[model samples]
Target: MLSSNIFSGPIATDAPPASIGSRKDHPVPRLGIAAAAPIQTNKFYANFFLGNQTAPTYLHPYSVFWAGAKDTSGSWGMAISHIDANQRVYGSETNPVTGTPRYYINPVGISSICISAKELGSTTAVTSDALTAFSARIILRASLQGASVIEFPLVQGSAFVTAVFNGACPLIQTGIFYKTVTRSTKEARPGITKYKLYLEDGTTWLLYAHHTKGDPLDLQIINNGLAQAKGPFYGVIQVAKDPGNADSMYDRTCGVYATDVELSGSAHGEKGTYTFNFKKAGMNLTTTLAMFALPHHQTSFDDQTRDKMTDVKLQTTTKGIAIAVVADSWTMVEPSLPVSIGFVPWLPEAGSISNISSTNKTFIHNIAQQEMKQDILAQTDQPSMYFAGKALAKFAVLIMAIHDILGDNNLAQAGLERLKQAFARFAENKQQYPLVYESAWGGVVSTASYANGNASSDFGNTYYNDHHFHYGYFIYCAAVIGHLDPSWIAANKAYVNMFVRDIANPSPQDKFFPVSRSFDWYHGHSWAHGLIETGDGKDQESSSEDSMHAYAIKMWGNVSGDKKMEARGNLMLAIQARSFPMYYLYTKTNNVQPPNFIGNKVAGILFENKIDHLTYFGPQPEEIEGIHMLPLLPHTPYIRARDFVEEEWNTYFANGRAENIVGGWRGIVYANRATFDPKGAYAFFSTPGFDPSWLDGGASLTWYLCYSAGM
Candidate 1:
């Protein structure tokens, strides 16, 4: 096949290889490791060549050269399966003698490079599978030049035989993987331009693909001034398994293409190549085929967004984790969990005491805590990983609320356990991590390599990290899931501790990785803004229980029965009241209104910046911390239901939002389903609402506020 020389040297020669950087006869693939020239526009992103978890935006480990930039330049993923998983054609690999000990050869999935193609005149992409394959069929997407027509040559390496061109193709595509369904030409045009397809199976068979006619040329194939064909055009096609092999040339024996179809606009160009590392698809615990399909976009939202709550929650959880067998699409997610969507529906108040029962008047209110937990407010700009966390969080939140809403504690408890199982997939040692770009689910991602590289956005528990928000929010879930069969909480104490510690001192490091200076896409904004590493944020000096840390201390207090935890919560609450921007105005200009509070989101302040008038908006006057926190803050939905009696909550039904006390913010985008300039305080009506396809562009956050002091 290949001139037996490609396998030039002994692969595993360096037994107990000298440590890296050693100078004595060092040889470990002598690989080139140059830093790819950085694109100056966005400095924060370094995924183009860096092998960190945050830069998972590019499919460098799995995609092929022909796939184009799913996120970056020169990042094609390739893999080597343990076995012939999805059998493809034409390739080669060396096999050791029968009794010799075999090396771990195919563990990476792909065996070798592939080289095969036909002339420009060919129609079908089919290549003949003449020789035994040592590799698989490589996929190529033709999206360059914005032209509908494309011509790819069937090649072995530098050389080309024929071309595979789609002349006068009407339908232009955005991504590769376009399906060919049309049986014949929609029209006909000039000089060998009108092409059709046929096939044969062999190496280097004669190809037959036609070019569209330049003008209305005389052709018998035209019917009433139009051209159409009922059957597949005739042609010779060829195939191969690996490109290195000498016999890898394509032929028509396999019906790849018939003879005599001319190619007009065919040209050969070079696209960089890459080597992939793969494994048995099942080895990674990707349970369903649905995981491999293209990704379904999460519903986008803006600051304080108020819609698509359910869909966002569902996509977050269901996407790469669960395999839905029974029903397809959101319309079918059954036994709908109790959801408290935006705005309690207006059913005219049927006068107070004269009614039979308070429950009758406050039907939605009876399940207020339960409904609130289920009322997810997912935004469109969130990372899919964020959605993954949402999925788990949604399930946990709903289950915890079940007992309160339906008075079925057992069902709620059962739901938590199921949720735990789902969340476990994203956890690294029982602690959540960001989701994979192409989660082993239906939604495929192409933005893994943007300046906004944020693979860890959804699962991290650092204060600013969205997953941190989820971690604190999910504490109630942990209790329920472990109530019945308790083992996880105690077993993963380290994880719990790390989570708590990170929450207390969520600093620039926790918010980002490497350093803040590496990229600008990342900046501290208190939400999934991007992977901003500022070397700032709130860094802690000690892990010991202290008043400075409220969230962490509260968590540990609940779990460890530590008194200092409560004190810390108290102190943290006090600090937050002054700095949180919920009630204070920034004075950025004379404006920045509705909610006058100027928070990191409203003020565009990085954590590293000092809180002086010159840096931050300055602390507000007369701010009360924990004094007003309790009446408004609902306890974990589960605990509230179980601990608080009916009498305790009945008063809440009469007046929920009388205080006008504003606190937590989801984001402005969350309030309205449109984009807003982050620099501005309010959303602009001048621009059209974001087209759903551009969810990432106009993503917004929704803010939440406690409504009353009476509770």
Candidate 2:
């Protein structure tokens, strides 16, 4: 059995026997007002009684009380309780020495239960003597509203038992509760008053009372009084016994009045009024109150700026009132709820490579072998001469692939040495690295603070903006290093895991990072900027880098035996394969696309809510061409539309753009295009006097050769 202490607050000391029944004439503990001074502290009170019909009148040993709030002055108190426990009941007076005296407030308009003492807390078998005694009591207090003395019949034989009042407690309910007052002129019934109150949780409660209908305290005047009052309005609702019924409570006709009307509108200008115009013009008391009390009728809203108003819907029998209540802006709503994600990795199951002739493959191989020799001999011992992690990751990717395809242990060892040096630098001077991993933010800091009091160029960068693009290269390099040297992986897995957690893990439970901040579950792809708020919102400029991120995750997950990561990678690829074509990559005869049609050129950056078909840096030809080339590097078995590749080649590369393509981009574009037109791609690379300087450090001649061979 679970220990009672496992459940905090009030818990039954023992289990009650099954045969327990209600007893009468129990000696009631006298309770008197200990101190009714205006509540001066803004501290939280555990229990405040709000009368709900279904609420229990008597205290239960195991009952958990609803949380209560007191303003700074403590003049007023509001609490919701499902059950009464004699511990510190707010808004009521209690004398500890005599137990209790005076009257008890019960929920006026609802039903309550009378339970036996044994039922309160009995874990063992109940003795006959234990069953004979009653456990609780109830007493009536005189009406504070000038009503006649109220009394209950005294039982002669049994011990006294406490009676509980019942009514709705907005705090105990699951949905939002808020009060709104509007200023527009609306009809006011003489004795009826309407109130729309909100709970801190953002659940709204609509109340209508007929008691003060004809008085100066009617709903309209009350609104005006609150609008003009001294401090923000705070209230306490009281429920008393019905004079007409001895055995039951009154219906909806009971009085519901504000306890402290003095604090209604004070400092009105400082605290703005929350106003609302009901859907209809008048109020329907029964339906409105009933709906507020009904559990099924409750709803919640997300606090998003784009569609804040549409998050909730309020329907009323009569048009709701147009009134406003004074409150601080911070008290209006809650922060946005955590995002929900559904990530399923999809491993590429099928697709065939277009065949390349042996003559072309041999020609491509000769070019790749020569480039590999030069790259291997170019490594330097000096650390400062080495490229940054992002650039180094690219070189590692190419060299590792070259070594694997050609069975060259010399090249593999050379690549391993470079990786080792890179790892050593990161380990020794992690703080100096541009892409420093930040445990506090659960992502890498793109820029670092230098010892010379200068911040790196990318310091204080936003989340996930270029994370995938930057981290993908590193993660891909790590995966390749792990594959080439298992010992290196065993030594560096922890360091490598940081990148994995940043890019793929979707659970906020991770202590080091936020849940998949970059990936958008709604869009079925990742966004680059996570927390950074651009005026236009987050966007992803490099669709290729997006795919590269997934590819790296998939490969690393496979090597690391994390099926979930592999699956996420596949799922990302699958989604991008479909979403990118629809949004980023344009083909002829495209009908369904983002608004503001640009030509068939790929959209360089896609934002969350908007689409800009332009690149971030500008409309450079390489920027447009490279977006389609990056995903082909890893060449995981995922499908890329051949038609799209053909279209890109015809639209951009086929028209002499390849001749002007500089550095690594030339090889990337030509190699990727080789997938479709091997003869043309091979002929271009094989031409005499071709400059090896044209090859990007990230580009792999081995990959070019492999593609030419249809591998």
TM-score of each: 0.28, 0.49
User: Which 10 consecutive positions of candidate 2 have the poorest summed lDDT?
Assistant: 124-133
lDDT, residue 596, candidate 2 = 26
Q: Which residue ranges in model 1 land beyond 4 Å of their true spot?
A: 1-385, 404-406, 427-467, 470-476, 479-488, 505-556, 560-562, 581-710
Q: Residue-wise lDDT of candidate 1 within 1-711, one digit each (tens)?
A: 111221122111121111111112111111111221111111221111122211211111111122122222111221111112122121131111111111111112221221121111112221111110011122222221232222222211101122233333221111211122123243221112222211111111111233233322122322211223223222211122222222112111111221111111100111111111111111112311111111211111111221212211101110121111111111100111111111111111211111122332243233334333432323212335434433443344344334433345565555555565554543442222332212111111123232244433232221123323344433333443443335666654443433343333212222211111111111111222222332122211111111112333343444443333333333233223222322121222212121122211122222221111112222321011111111111221211121121222122211332122233211212221111111121222112342223111112111111111001
**Whole-model Cα lDDT of every candidate shown, in order:** 0.23, 0.37
Kindly list the per-residue Cα lDDT of model 2 for residues 15-121, writing each as its tens digit.
Answer: 11221121211111112212221110100110011121111111111111211112111111112222121221222332221222211222211111111111111
- What residue runs in model 2 are displaced by over 4 Å at the alpha carbon? 1-365, 374-390, 427-440, 446-464, 530-532, 594-598, 636-640
Residue-level error in angstroms, candidate 2, position 291: 23
Q: Highest TM-score, which number?
A: 2
lDDT accuracy of residue 51 in candidate 1: 26
